[model samples]
Target: MIIQPKQRNIAYRCPECASSIFGIVGKFALSADMLRLKCSCDKGSALDINKTNDGKIRLSVPCLFCKQNHSYVVSESVFFDRDKFLLNCPYTGMDIAFIGDEQTVNSELARTEEEIRRLMAGFEAEDISELQPEDMNEDEILPDPAVYDTLRFLVKDLEAEGKLECLCNEGSYELRFCDGGVQVYCERCGATYTFGATTPALAEEYLNIDYLKLK
Candidate 1:
């Protein structure tokens, strides 16, 4: 199924111009660019990411309430690190996802400008009905806003500092990550902590929040 833009829904309709607001994200081949989010009204914006992250892929489109656009840099971990990670992209049925980046996104827009211009020209001349489709059934299930905001800040920082470290407590421990689920165990302490779980307590260890919530 095609990924539908979130804005066309009745709920996100604008009170001012009644224009739809949407946030789209995708990457181009071999480039780190966040595709420009274009509105039917000709409003376009770009975002930039610092390359130090060198992560896989990430995108943060603005909310319906606010039109400011933002982009993120993430690595394969976003998809591969999930608890029940799907091996493929549902929209394209592809093994790899078109990860979003600002630079890559701009290239796509430039390449497609002619097609887009044709569409826009038709739109300007005709009094066309709003071809708003239904909202997508499978929205990107991001973390709850309160929680997601913190992860955006912490995950990269911890990963960058090489501080996402795991130390063995009194008990023997094991660490395993496959298909997005991880297992951190202390065989000596006979303890285990799943991501974001605080259960299976360990005697002595430094743990990240994702690992602590598994309880």
Candidate 2:
């Protein structure tokens, strides 16, 4: 018997900006191991889907949801059994993206458009301050509280002492928190430093080093 090729479709969105990145559909053989795509944002962030050795699909991608990159693994059946797989931000429980077959994605997009229209039909301005990410509880919104707090304090301290200023005389640095850690970046110079925690107390140790040592 001849086996039919599997077709896949993926829809991406940056939860932080509530923006739709893109929708792509393609066909692959049963032996295909991985698929990769990029976000629509100017950042051109990456997203990857890999077929693991254990016959599961693993999604390793940058999340616009919590401003971090992380990985997620799902059973192989997820592709064939469901019309869509909605991936959520593990930290904030916000919908980050969806993947499935082409037909399902098109249908889902139509439904979403209709709902958007219905809501906008009677839309009105309201105070949206409560919706801001900063207003969210750090412990609840961060995937790893210990790492978040440790890095948050360290970066804030560095910034306060002017240790985070770019040598190119550009500007100060800022932190973007994600699943397991944070990204330190300079806006004008585009420099970045990343820290993560794979074991207990790793982030804490990294935060305790002297400023000179950090440089």
Candidate 3:
């Protein structure tokens, strides 16, 4: 009996020279919906396959020559050949090639931060005049309430209290800190992974541990 490794279904083409290149597919993270491929030309390209179907997938990297980001697409084929992934930059005609996979930790972390920011923004734009404090017909003074300030203070307080936590973009197990370990778990998924200890001394040792927003 013989054992065989799984084969790839990669394909790419160059933008400038229209050259074809082969790639080695590696790192398939189903949890993160990610796939990584290394191009033969020595340039590495990382993509989010989950985003491809919706036309949201783009080269994980910004355009090297143009520095332009949008308007790029990263699609896959059931019968794709690695040769299709190779291409020259249409704008610069440079040898545009790539190899390698996206680090799920980094990409997912950045994506979570982005979601947090967007949520903060939406919370900011909300009209809270009705929820504001103002003077009444009487001569009584009032406090501003300061919901945002309070929230910020709570965030800091939680960190100091060793309860700082956050959630990743996946909307699953939250990034919670306890016993000096960052855990990813949800009652539903039951997925939990300890990241690091609760102290700074061990922070470096378990630097790669994933964290979640404190609830």
Cα-based lDDT for every prediction = 0.33, 0.55, 0.34
Ranking by lDDT: 2, 3, 1
Per-residue lDDT value at 26 in model 3: 33
Cα lDDT for residue 106, candidate 3: 34
Tens-digit lDDT track for model 2 on 73-100? Answer: 5555555455566554545444356677
Q: Model 2: runs farther than 4 Å from truth?
A: 1-5, 15-19, 23-30, 107-141, 144-215
Q: State the lDDT of candidate 3 residue by residue for 85-138, as single tens digits.
A: 322232333323333233332343344446434644766833223222242321
State candidate 3's TM-score: 0.24
C-alpha lDDT of residue 94 in model 1 = 17
RMSD of candidate 3 to the truth, in angstroms, is 19.5
Candidate 2, residue 214: the lDDT equals: 25
Clash count list over all predictions? 33, 0, 35
TM-score of each: 0.28, 0.46, 0.24
lDDT of 2 at 162: 54
Q: What is the lDDT of residue 61 in candidate 2?
A: 54
Error of 2 at 19 (Å): 4.4
Model 2 — TM-score against the truth?
Answer: 0.46
Models, CA RMSD each = 16.1, 17.0, 19.5
True-vs-predicted CA distance for residue 154, candidate 2, Å = 36
